[model samples]
Target: MFSTALQSLSSHLPGCASSGGTSLKANLKHITVTLATWDAVWEVYLDPKWARQQLRLYGAQDRAMEQFFKKLKKEISELSMKRHGRAKQRVLFVGAAGIGTRGDWGGDAVLWACCK
Candidate 1:
């Protein structure tokens, strides 16, 4: 299940060449998450502010980004399998808010590297 999820994620990323378990990038996009908590279900993509409030109340404040991606990947796979549809849609990653780390894609180099 993890490998399938990783493959699905890799194929959707920009400039990634996947072949039998290579490397991947961890870049993230701005995605809205749908979550149900406390008798209210939220489609948080439309309203960030409301989502934040609800997530905070639901005790997901620390892992909001993780939750977003988890839900997104699952939904993408499910939708594609259920409808026989394509899951290769463009995603917009707004701002540097969700970046896990700082990296350098050298000014004029070929390799991309990130330092932990």
Candidate 2:
């Protein structure tokens, strides 16, 4: 199950050869994780505010949501580093141009590199 989920997330990312923007590549391995579940699990591992914000964005927050986010974050971070190595990679935002709403190429690239 965990491997499947990781594979799903990896498939959403773009390959190094892809010319399209990072968002499209990054979204290759898509997984719909509930905010509540994430909060409940991550809260114990991370800050409550950070976990709450992350879960709220996904609309999945629920009571007793703690540690999960922290664990998830640690796992993801470790996995990402393992995949991409310790070197810092550059990301270029390729989507629309704006402040908050604009697409983040750099962010997408980083995510793809880390998650893939």
Could you tell me every candidate's TM-score relative to the true structure? 0.24, 0.21
**Model 1 root-mean-square deviation:** 25.5
Candidate 1 per-residue C-alpha lDDT over 12-80 given as tens digits, one digit per residue, 9 for 90 to 100: 875665344434333221111222242344344457897677657545533454456556666766887
Report the poorest 10 consecutive residues by lDDT, candidate 2: 58-67
Off by over 4 Å in 1: 1-62, 85-116
Clashes of each: 2, 29
lDDT of candidate model 2 versus the reference: 0.49
Residue 107 accuracy (lDDT) in model 1: 26
Candidate number with greatest lDDT: 2
In the range 1-116, model 2's lDDT, one tens digit per residue, is 75667567667764745535655324533433453367766666687787678767544422222234345556766877888885344333344444433323344443333333
TM-score for model 2?
A: 0.21
